[model samples]
Target: MATHMTSKKIQNRMKRRVALNKGMSGIFLLATSFGVFILGVLFYQILTEGIPYINLEFLTGKLSTNPDRAGIMGAILGTLWLMAVVIPVTIILGVGTAIYNELYAKQGKLQSIIQTNISNLSGVPSIVYGILGMTIFANMLNLGSVVLAGGLTMSLLVLPIVIVSSQEALRAVPGYLSEASIGLGATKWQTIKNIILPAALPGILTGSILALSRAIGETAPLVVLGIPALLLPFPGGLFDRFTVLPMQIYYWTLDASLVGEYQFLASATIIVLLIMLFILNGTAIVIRNKFQRRY
Candidate 1:
C-alpha cells in the first residue's frame, strides 16, 4: 500500500510538470503572435495612407519646395547608382573572402581568430560602419558624400553578412564533390569555378540579395556621410552627389508636421521602399528554390 501511494504521487508530479510546460509554451506563442499583429497593423496603416499618393508624377517628378510638385526621381536614380556600385564590390570581395577562408585557409588559431572577428563584425551597428566610411572613404579618400562614397560605406556594412552566408553555403556543398574533382585532376580554381560555385550559387546569391536589401534600407550610415536631401539633378555617375529612398522618407516624415501633404508623400515613399525590399527578397527566394541542389 505504501509503495502504491508513492508511485501515485510521482505520477501526479509528472503530470503537473507537463501541464506547466504546455502553459509556458502557450504564453510564448501568444507573445510571438502579438509581434506579428503589431507588424500587420503598421503595414495596414502605411498602405492605406500611402497608396493613393503613388502615381507617375510623384514617381517621376524632381523634388520641389512645393509639396504639390515633389517627386522621387532623383532619389530613385541615386539608389540605382549606389546599387550599381554596391552589388559588384560586395559580391567580388565577399565571395572571394568566403572561398579563401573556407577552402584555402588552414584551420588553426589564426583562422579561428579571423572567423570570430568576422562574426563579431556582422553584429556591429550600422552607424559604426558609417563613421568608419566617413573617415576612410569620405575624408581619407576624399570621395565626399557621392554615390561612390555611400556605396563603399554600405559595402563595408554588409560585407561580413555576405561572407558568413557564403561560407555557410560553401560548407554545405558535399566534400565528395570537391574530392572527386581533385581525383579527376582538375585544378583548384577550375574545380571551385565549375563544381563548388555552381552548387553553392543558390545560397551565395540569396545571402548577397538579402545583404543588398539591408544596405538599401539603411539610413544611419548615409546620414553620417551627409548625403543631401535635395539633389536637384539626378545622379548620372558614381561620383555624383546623391540621396536615396530612405533619406527622402526620413526628411519628408520630419517635414510632415509642418506640411500635411508631406505625410502622404512619406507614406508613398515608404510603400516604394517596401516594394524594393520585397522584390529583392523575392528574387533571392526564387533563385534559392530554382538552383538549390539535392546534395
Candidate 2:
C-alpha cells in the first residue's frame, strides 16, 4: 500500500511539472508571435508606400524641379561609390586589428586596454564620428567635405563593429589548426594566412554583410560630415561633391515647400533601401549554406 502511494505521488508531481512547462511555452510563443506581427505591419506599410512609386525612370533619372522627371541616379551612384571605398578599407583595418588582437597579442593589461577602448568605441554615437571626421579628416588633414572625407568618417563609425565581428569569427577557428600549422614549420603569419584565415573566411564574410548593410542605411553621419544638399548629376570621383538617398530624403523632408513631393520620394527611397538590405542578407544566407555544404 505504502509503495503504491509513493509511486502515485511521484506521477502527480511529474504531471504538474509538464503542465507548468507547457503553459510557459505557450506564453513564449504568444510573445514571439506579437513581435513578428509588429514587424510584418511595419514592412507592409513601407511596401505600400514605396512599391507603387518605383519606376525605371525614377531610378535612372537626375534630380529635377519637375516631379515626373526626378530620379535617384546620382544619389544611388554616390551610395555605391561610398560602399566601394568604405567596405574594402574597413575589411582591411578591422580584420587586421582582429588578427593582431586575437593571434599576436598576449592577454596583458595593454591588450585589455586596447580591447576596452574598442568596446567603448562601438557604442559611441555616429554623430560623434561626424564631429571627429570634420575636425580631423576634413580640417586637420585637409581632405575637405567630399566623398572621400565622408567615406573615411563612416568607416570609423563602423570599424569597431567589424573588429568585434571579425574577432568572433577568428576565435571560432579551432586552436589545433594553428598548432598543427606551426608544427609543420609554418611561421605565425603563414599559419594565419593559410590555415586559420581560410577556415574563418565564411564567418568573416557573414560579419562583413552586417557592417555593409549598416553603412548603406546610415544618414546622419554623412549629413553631419557635410554631404552636399544637392547633386543633380552623378559624381565623377570620390573627391567630386555628391549626395546619398538618405541625405536626399532628409533634405527634402525638412523643406516645408517640397514636403508633399519629397515625402513620396522618401518613401520610395526607403523601399529601395529595404530591397538592398534583403539582397545583402540573402547573399549572406546563401554564402553560409554553400560553405556549410562544402566544408
Candidate 3:
C-alpha cells in the first residue's frame, strides 16, 4: 500500500511537469504569432500607401518645397555618398580593433575593462553618439555637416557592434585551425590571412552588414548633426552637404499635418529605404553564403 502511494505521487509529479511544458510551449507560440501578425500588417500598410507614388520621374526627381514636385534623388545620392565614407572607415577601424583585441592583446584586467566598455558602448543611445559626433567631428575636426562628418559619426555609432561581432566570429573559428597553421610554420599574420580570417569571413560580413543597416536607418544622429532634409543640389562628393532617406522621411512626417500629401511622400521615401535595405541585406547574405560554403 505504501509502495502504491509513492508510485501514484511520482506519476502525479510527472503529469504536472508535462502540463507546465505544454503551457509554456503554447505561450511561446502565441507570442511568435503575434509578432508575425504585427509585421504583416505593417508591410501591408506600407505597400498600399507607398507603391502608387513610386515611378521613374519620382526616382529621378529632386527635393522641392512643393510636395508634388519633391523628389528623393538628392537624398538617395547623399545616402550613397555617406555610405561611401562609412563602409571603408568602419570596416578598417572596426575589424582592425577586433583583430587586435582578439588575437594580439594579452588577456588581462585592461583587456577585460576594454571589452566591457565596448559591450556597454554597443548599448548606448544613438543620440549620445550624435552629440559626440557633433563635438568632435563637426566642431573639433571642422568637418561640419558634410557627408564625411555624418559618415564618421555613423562609423563611431556602429563601431562597437562591429567589433563585438567580429570578435565573436573570430572566437568561433576552431582553435585547431590556427594551431595547425602555426605547426606548419606559418606566422601569426599568415595564419590569420590564410586560415582564421577566411573561416570567420562569413560571420564578420553578416555582423558588419547588420551594423551598417542600423546606421542607414538612424535619424537621431543626423538630426543632431543638422543634416538638412531639403538639400537642393545632389551631394557630388563626400564633403558636400547632404541628406539621407531617414532624414527626409522624418522631416516629411513632421510636416504632414500642414501638408497632407507630405504623409504620402514620407511613405514613398520609406518604401525606397526599405528596398535599399533589402538589397543590401540580400547582397550580404549572398556573399556570406558563398564564403561560408568556401570555408
Task: Pick the lDDT winner.
Answer: 1
Among these predictions, the greatest TM-score belongs to 3
Model 1 per-residue lDDT tens digits across residues 1-295: 9999999999999999999999999999999999999999999999999999899999999999898889999999999999999999999999999999999999999999999999999999999999999999999999999999999999999999999999999999999999999999999999999999999999999999999999999999999999989846988998999999999999999999899899999999999999999999999999999998896
- Global local distance difference test of model 2: 0.84
Cα shift from native, residue 98, model 3 (Å) = 1.0
TM-score of each: 0.94, 0.88, 0.95
Q: Which residue pairs clash within candidate 1?
A: none
TM-score of predicted structure 2? 0.88
Please list the C-alpha lDDT of all candidates, in the order they appear.
Answer: 0.96, 0.84, 0.92
After TM-score superposition, the amount by which residue 240's alpha carbon in candidate 2 deviates from its true location, in angstroms, is 1.0
RMSD of 1: 2.0
Candidate 3 residues lying further than 4 Å off, grouped into runs, are: 1-10, 293-295
Candidate RMSDs in Å, in order, are 2.0, 2.8, 1.7
As a TM-score, model 3 comes out at 0.95
